[model samples]
Structure formats: C-alpha cells, structure tokens
Target: MTSDTPARRRARVFSRRRSAPSRARRRLGAAVRMIAALALAGGVYTAFTPGAFAEDNVQLSAAAQEGKALFDNSCISCHGRDGQGVEERGPSLIGVGSASVEFQVSTGRMPMTRQEAQAEQKTPQFDETQTKQLAQYIQELGGGPELPEGELVEDLKTNPDALARGGELFRINCTSCHGFGGGGGALSSGKFAPSLHDATQEQIYAAMLTGPQNMPVFGDNQLTPDEKREIITYITVQLQDDRDPGGLFNLGRYGPSTEGMAIFLVGIVLLVFTSLWIAGKS
Candidate 1:
C-alpha cells in the first residue's frame, strides 16, 4: 500500500526529466560518431584515387601551357581555377571546345566588362594568336567541337545548286530568330539575335557548332559539314551584296517590322507638313 505522497511524485517527475536528457545525449553522440565515420571514408577514398579526380599534374602542350597562364591571369575570376567556372559568373568550359573560344574571343564577346543578360560583341582584348592560346587551353582541358580547317565557303561559290540549298536551309533554321533578311531580332530576355550582316564565316560556323547563347548546336547529325559551308556562303555572299533589287537602302532588312516603322514615321511627317501648307493657303 504505497501512499501518493508529494515527495514521491516529485522524485518520479525528476527521474523522467533526467532520462530525457540522457536519451538526447545518446542520440547526439551517435550522430557525431556517424559524421566522423563518413568523413574518414571520404578522405580514404580520395587519397587512394589521385588521378581519378584531379588532373593538376597532367603535362600540357606549349600552347596549352601559355593558354593556362592567360586564363589564370585574365579569366580565373570568372572561369575558376581549372575553367570549371565560378558560381553565378561563368559557365563550365569543359566541353565547349576551341571553336567556341575562337568565336567568343574573336568577336570580343567574352572577357566581359560586366555581367549582363548577354555578352555583346566589342573590341577584342586578345589578338588572334592569344585567342588561339586561350582556346587551346580549354580544348586540352576537355576536347570539344573543333573548328573546320581551310576555306568553309569556297566550294559553295562555284556551285549554284549548293547555294540554293543553303538559302532554303537558312530560311528554315535561322529565319525564325534572325529574321527573313538577317537583320536580327529581340529575344525573350535581354539577349538578342545578332545581325548576321557583320558575322564572318568562322563566326557563323562556330555559332552553329557550339550553339552559343540561345542558338542550338548544329552538330553533324543536324547539319552536315557541306551543308554548313553552303549556309555560310548564302550569308556572306548573297545577303551581303550591296545591290538590293528593291532599293539602295536595305531599311535594316527586318521584314515587316522595319518597313512598318519607317512608313509610320514618314507618313506622320508628311501629314503634319500637308496640314501646315493647307492652313497657309487658306
């Protein structure tokens, strides 16, 4: 017959409180032990597999070595130590390839002055030789789509059949973004489809190969080498010709948009002047 004494109840409550703390301590200790074990396992795995994760010691060619130095000096802040890319700054260049580098550097679209919606074409920071070196470093880091050798548009010049094929291809694949006359157009974001009138053959080829920015990659599976060359010919030769059948001024060649704007402005001016002349005659 145990009586319900206040002291007895107090003692039981105190014991329960003590047990809870002990249980919590045990759980915390177990968690610490598990974390320590995981850390040890990771260290051991990394130590045993040196070459599997790191390429720091891999020997580089002379050009690649120079490129490395250039990258570290000018590009490391954005591109990261091994061209892995910096967070919220640049993208990983691992598989972007030399052609991409050539296009970006040659067009002066990189070594960006500031982070914007897109990199715009400007005066190049590196010369042709230096650009190649930077590209070589990226290529050696991880091989990617390479630039085609020799003249890309030469063969298409002699073949009228191929030139026609190129025009059709451009209309199908590029006109949606670049506009019918290649004057370029606005995109969803701050980015824009640049005017192809200024783009060179190499730049066009690289743009298609790497699919810079919004452009999709046109690999061999999509557009064959011969097909690529033909497209380049259509843009550089036919589109660039100063002799427009319609008139001297191309009016930006932006299809209906440019023409509409021009007509609206010119019409407004004429209407204002015509009203003024009628008032004076009256």
Candidate 2:
C-alpha cells in the first residue's frame, strides 16, 4: 500500500509538469489579446477626436462659404443674388471663372464707384485674402477658364528657350495693343492696353487667362502653358527689364512708329534749314 501511494504521487507530479507549458501559453495569449484591445481603443479614440474631425470637415469648405457671404454682402447689388447680373449694374458671371474674379478684384477694378467705359485699376476694397475668397465664390458659382495654380514665375526663369520663343509669340500676337516693348497702346474708346512694366507674373498670367475688360480671352486652348510662360519671360526679362545693351537708342521701345515720326520731323526741319542756307548763298 505505501509503495502504491508513492507511485500515485509520482504520477500526479508528472501530470502537473506536462500541463505547465499549456497554462503558460494560455496566459501569454490572454495578455496579447488585452494589449490588442487597448491599441484598438486608442485608435478609435483618435479617429473620433473632435478637433481632428472638425479640422478635416470644416476647413475644406470654409473658404468657399466665406466667399459666398462676401459676394452676397457687397456684390449682390450688381451681380444679383444668383450671380446672373442685373441689367446695367453688372454683366452675367455664370462662366467668367475664378481668374476673372481674381484679376478684377485683386486689381481693384471692381466694386466700381461708378459705371464707366472701362474699369480703372485703383486701391483695392478687399485685401488679398478677401479677394481670393471672392474668387472662390465666383469659381464655385460658375465654371470657366482657371489660371494655372502654383509658382508661375519660377518656371519662366528656369526655361532655357523662354526668351526666344516669347519674343516671337509676343511680336506676332501682342504688338498691336501692347507695343513691341510692352509699353501699352491705345484701344477703341478710352480703353488701352496696360503696360507690362510694373505687372507681376501673377497679374500678367491672370490677365491672359481672364481677359479683363476688352482684352480677348486667351484660354489654355489658345495659348498652352509653355507658350504663356515663354511670352511672360520675354515680356518681363527682355522687354520690361531690358538695359538696351550697346550704344543704340531704344526710342521709347515703341519700335518703328515713334522712330518714323521722329525721322519725318527731323527731315522737315533739316530741309527748311537747307532751303534758307541755299537762298542766303545765292
């Protein structure tokens, strides 16, 4: 009986030893599950955070809404509640695009004090932020040609053949109104093509895209991005910033028209002087 008891105790010990690894594995698995639950809870909390969700949803459409408000307050009289325009107050802006709004507002040619033949550039009623908001409103209201986004000036400087290509394109297309040197020239009525002297790259690009006032719209189809950049390079670098290298005169950068007028006047004066000299000698 004593020997049998010892054998039973040995058997019991062996069974416990065999089950120890299984118990340890179960404990480890439970710990892993608890850790996974904690991580999942944390992820859920972060995703539902008020600030994060608000920032994601609210800011995305804020600009356009604010722009709509601005349009309602100041522009409703001229542009109408639906942006359809009111007779002589304003023209329809259904498809004018954000470029037109930005150019007109940023340049302060809008929110006119009085209706005239043309809107003149003046001190802006709204700052740049407000102007952009207005542009966003106009953009959302109606779809039209959009100015290319991002840094337009940087690309013009980097392009190697910009100057050459721009010169040719400018002479062919721009000389009639802008002059050969971008000095600007007369148009019908009191309207005139503005000079490119002080115009920034953005303004120039906007002008081309929107065709403010009587200027014809040169959309992306008419002038591709590369062509527009080339034209801007020529206008800014060669025409606006030219030092007129060598001893030759620039003649106001007006090309042959002004030179021809000056030559004709000079010739007339010389002929009169020669006639007097001949009479005196005779």
Candidate 3:
C-alpha cells in the first residue's frame, strides 16, 4: 500500500493539472461557445422578425426608381453612387429622407451652382413631378421625417384664431433668426436666414422638419403638428402681408439696425439738403 505523503499528493495534483486544459484554454473555449450561441440566437431572431424581413426585402416604387435614374444622372457627381456621398463634396443622403430632398430640390438649393458658403435658392432644375420622384427615392433608401398628409393649414388664412396663435408661436420660436418680420436675418459666416415671404406651406413644413443649413430642426417632439400648422398660418397670413414702407426710403428690412441707420443717415442728409435750399432762397 502506498502511503499518502506530501510528495505523492503533489505528484497527483500535477498529473490532474496536466490532464485538464490550461485555465486560459478553458476560458477561450467557453468564450467561443458563448459567441456561437449568441450568433445562432441572432440569426433565429432576424429570420423570424417580420419587420427585419420587410426592411431587407423592400423594393423601390416606380417613382423611387425614376428618382434613382435622375439621381444617377444628376446628383451622383457629388453625392456618390447609392447616395453614400463623397468625402468633402457632399453629405450622405441615405438617412435624410424625402422631406430634405423636397426642400432642397423644390427650393432649387441642391445640385448646387458651384460650392459656396451656402447654397442659395435659385430656379429649380427639376419640376414638381421630378422633385417628388427624387424625394421618394431618398425616402425609400433610408426612412426619415416625412410630411403628414392632408392640408397643412389651407384654411389658416381665414382662421383669425389660428393666425393669432401662429403669430405668437412664430414670435417665440422664429423671431431670433428670422427677425420679427420674417424677412430673414444675417447669420454668422456667409449663411443667412432665408426670406419666408414666398415660402409655401409644404416648403415651410419641410424646412421645419429637416432644419436646412443653419436652421435648427423643429421636430414634432419640440413643436406639435398643430403648432406647426399654426406657425405656417401666421407666416403665410401675417408676415407675407406685412409689407415694408414702400420706396427707396425703406432700405433693407433689417429691423432696428436699419431703422436706426435710416434715422441717423437719412435724418442728417435731409437736414443738410433743407439748409442748402433755405440758404439759396435767402
């Protein structure tokens, strides 16, 4: 019979340790199995989820297809293939959606005429149908903010309450950048807040949703749908009609700065002119 001495016990322990995998090896094996199990679970979930399948199997509509064609011909230069966008040339349009495309194309801001500090509004290259098709293509490529259906305040012109509410909303939300009159104000850098005078309801809504250029996005979370409609009503009904005092005397409607300049410069010039006339008559 072998006595269980410390030497014999040490030998047995070493043998067991040798027979078993090293701690590092055991941990590596466990990690590999865990990863494989997770991968299998993910695969099953992806296969079973209807939403995942729908997103993966989506096919472009006719309008989207036509828009893709137009994009290939016209927008591909800077935006790149599949609208991935080229570095430094243009931003990726994948997630921008239809609202952004409509606002840019309809307002004739995209397909920019030479890269400047900002893309100013010009005559649109694409007409309404083409613009819609383009917007649809972008909307399908990557889902994003979309304009709600039905009227965006068609009756706002007649609704005095709506106009009043809208004016108040506009004053609170828009007065800083757009100025009190919505004639638009100069921003830092070359970018400027655009005049909202001629902007249509759709355009205004789109701008609010997308936040073109320096404009901050007024998402539904910040401003509800009805509030947007009211603001649109105010802009269309009140601001558009709020004309400047006519003639060359009005100068640019930069609010107080221009008013102050008119008071100082024009007042001094009138005084000088009246003095000369009085002296000559005497």
TM-scores of all candidate predictions against the true structure: 0.74, 0.68, 0.81
lDDT of 2 at 226: 82
lDDT of 1 by residue, 16-135 (tens): 999999999999999999999999999999888532332666678999999999999999999888888889988778778899999999999989999888889999999989999999
Q: Which stretches of candidate 1 lie over 4 Å from their true place?
A: 1-54, 243-246, 255-282
Given candidate 2, what's the lDDT at residue 164?
A: 85
Lowest summed lDDT window (length 10), candidate 2: 51-60
In angstroms, the error of model 2 at 195 is: 2.2
In terms of lDDT, model 1 sits at: 0.86
- Between candidates 1 and 2, which one is better according to lDDT? 1
Clashing residue pairs, backbone N/CA/C < 3 A, model 1: none
Tens digits of per-residue lDDT, candidate 2, 76-156, equal: 899886577789788877778888888888888889989998888888899889988888766766666677788775766
CA lDDT of each candidate? 0.86, 0.79, 0.86
Report the Cα lDDT for residue 103, model 3: 96
In the range 25-94, model 3's lDDT, one tens digit per residue, is: 8999999999999999999998875422114345999999999899999999999877778898988887
Model 1 Cα shift for residue 75 (angstroms): 0.7
